[model samples]
Target: MLRVKNPVLPGFHADPSILRVGNEYYIANSTFEWYPGVEIHRSRDMVTWEKVASPLSEKRLLDMDGALASCGIWAPCLSWSDGLFYLIYTNVRSWNAGAWKDTPNYLTTASSIEGPWSDPVYLNSSGFDPSLFHDDDGRKWLVNMEWDWRKTGSHQFSGILLQEYSTEQKALVGPIQKIYPGSEIGMVEGPHLYKKNGWYYIFAAEGGTSYEHAMSVGRSRCLTGPYEFHPHNPLLSSYGHPEIRLQKSGHASWCDTPDGRSYLAFLCGRPLPGTLDCVLGRETSIVELEWRDDWPYLKPAPGEELFPSGAVRNWPADSFEPPVVLDEYRKKGEFPPATKSIEYRFDGSAIHPDFKNLRTERDPEVYSLTSRPGFLSLRGGQSPVSHWGQSLLARRQTDFSFSAETKLEFAPTSFQHLAGLCWRYDETNQYLCALTFDENLGRVLKVLTFVDRQFMHYDPVPVPGDGPVWLGLTVQVDSGRFRYSPDGKTWRILRPVLSAAVLSDEFGGMGFTGAFTGMFCIDTLDYTARAYFESFKYTVL
Candidate 1:
């Protein structure tokens, strides 16, 4: 029996758009602010898959500092035609002239899978979750969220709109028609284009992308249509009550098995409070699909769960297996050390926001800490005074017991050049301890925290230090205690005063960022100021 294992994918992968070329399927998902944008994974037999490459990894493809982590790359769609793969995604840089700021929608293409792909053809279209679909007549169309009433004159969110795209000009070429007003059926954003059984399907998500979200389908005969909503509208259903991983559904991409059976890879939260999901962020999940009486049905095995709980599977077990990498930063006597997760920076390492580690493809050249031969070097600011340059190493803080480490050589002629470790939820809420060596002031250590965008805790009691000192962070979630360590062993209690609660959906739940984890870093520094790291490591002890 060729059984497609249920709950096929796991982890913080979301808004999946899958395309099958021959027996191989290629999938791309939204990669928000976490750089090397738009994670791409490939699969066979519609079950097991592995991440191969990201098309938006370079500076030309994305700009991270331009958008916050949760809002960068949202609901991307992929399609393979001729010998290239066409990708369409959204980046809302700013709306209402920068009031509702984020990335704008974009589109690009690649010939080979792993990329040195071309730059994105920026679109002036006002929307998000961009997807591309080709019609039977060899014409192509683009679908995205268009702020109809909201951008036009309302205070509420908007609906999904469709337009024709020109690959040659890398731009939208026609009048956008509002085919689906989510207000009519609870749909909000993340719309995908699909064709099936001689009819066109606009499979999209509705609601505010939170608890009320769900997948809906609308059909029409022509590209510019008189579309009809599905009678079985809210097709795939899950946790809308009691707040579970099933809360926000929809933003799906269709896939088919070798035997012609169909399935969908879409966004679903984890089990939550367990090994499952909680608002932190929307992850990806795959469900076996069946077209019974010309409608779609989603059924999973008895013990099936969504992502995070969905264990990684190596599909087509005979051909290939996904490689597992153990992050032992200190194992091989690695250089520039490993990044310090959460720690009290002492000596040499100060805070430099220039190194934008969270940056997407837009300015990777500005700041980079790589693992080629093992040493991490923070370059001078891309310019003399560049605050937007971010060059830091970070991990999604998902697990409980862990320690982050870093080796610092603070050669700061001025306090402006710095390196440190942090636990950043947003610009408003973060805890940072840094090491600084000013030319005239010598060396000193400082701890800073922010809550509700207001500064509350500041431990600027200066201490002198020389040589390389290790910075570590130990967090005990059960008791709500976060401690910092100079050496990985002894700990000092530094309290973070809150302007608002850090835990809860209201304060932006730190649930499941795909690359999200409590990480060790060299600090978010600039491309101009130089710093060197001798070692970096993280361990779950």
Candidate 2:
């Protein structure tokens, strides 16, 4: 029997759009502000998953030059019809600027998941989370939220809209119609259309994308009409019920197995108990379901109990398994340093795609492993402020308490040259501990923390070293400490123990992403400054 985990795909993999073509299952996730957007994962047994290829690999499709931390690609909808695969996503310029301002959605297609995807076809600037619905009769439709934030009313989110799409023309046609106004729950988005049992079903995310997040559905006999709301309304949610391990559970898509069994994949998070800090960010989880009287009900895992006393439910163990991680509960002493190596694991490691492949958002050809064997060479490009040229590589922080250290070799000549380890929650909220040349303090090491894009504290210490400096960070739940070691045996404190809770979704106003601790380099003045990283060691304590 295969034991499938709850968070089948973990860490920064959110707003999943799962599709099944034959026996192969393909899942696409939202890569907000990250390059190589729309990360796709493939699986056979529905338990073990592998990253196949990223669809948005070209810079022409996504230009995130100055995009904010959580404002790049929002919800990406992937589907297969006929012989080609279709993908639709939004380029969120800035969430802080305005809700509906300059947010353009686009569509792209490819014959195979791995190869040259067609150039992005502009869909509309109406709103984000766009999806393509191909009817069984060969007709196609596009559905998404109509953002009316400028309107002077409580209902800024203008209901879901639908439009006819011509696959041959590769464009949308006819008048847009407001199909379903949305459920009673506000902040509704992430809509996916499904037809089953001779009824058109609409599934959407509601109550924002936070702890109050939920999934609601409505059905109708026609494609666009006065859809009848399900009496149960939110078919599944963890909102208000704090006891549930899976919080912020919504934005779901349904899929059927080869044998005709039903399953749902959705975005969810597991935060620290009392602090409610989700360092792992929103992840993907699957749950089984059963239909009764034309309505769907979530079938919980074995021994699963809901708050306030709900019916005892269970699913076939071989087909479905609850979210389980190997090291989420291990103590500090349990992880022996000898056994813990930086060899990348898709579920836990910060390295996206794979280890040894360090990448910036949209900047390709910036880092090289062949130039210096066994070491990563990152050239200076733009500072972290710029979304495009920022020469940075980061992996999601999956544990509340963990220790990460890296050795950097760099010789800085000007103040513009900087290289170090960074704990980032976005461009604005981050912490940098690096080695740089200070005119007065020659070879100096410093630690700086930024909150809301402003420097909160800066501490510099004189370190007598020409090269090969070790920078480390130790984060224990709410607090974090920085250290610098001249030799592997001896270390010195670089900064005062500070509050890492600020990186939480609740504290970091720009909080769609969790903290990413990794090495980075910035040549704000020119693209000449270079830094080589020898090794990286990360351990979940």
Say which candidate scores most in lDDT.
2
Tens digit per residue, CA lDDT, model 2, 1-541 = 2245467775678899999998888899988877778888887656667789787777777777667678888899999998989999998886665434567999998899996898999989888889999999999999998788777545467789999999888889999999988888877788999998899999998888888788888999999977898777687677766766778888899888777777889988878767677777888888877787786777654565422255322211122542222342233222122112353322222334532112234333466664566677788877666666677777767666788888888888776788888887776667888777788777677777777767764656876758588888898877888888887669887666767766766675537766778878888777888888877778878
TM-score of 1: 0.74
Q: What is the per-residue lDDT of model 1 for residues 2-25, given as tens digits with 9 covering 90 to 100? A: 333223444356778878887787
TM-score of each: 0.74, 0.89
At residue 62, give the lDDT of candidate 1: 76
lDDT value for model 1 = 0.56
| Model 1 lDDT-worst window of ten | 313-322
Question: What is the alpha-carbon lDDT of model 2 when measured against the actual structure?
Answer: 0.75
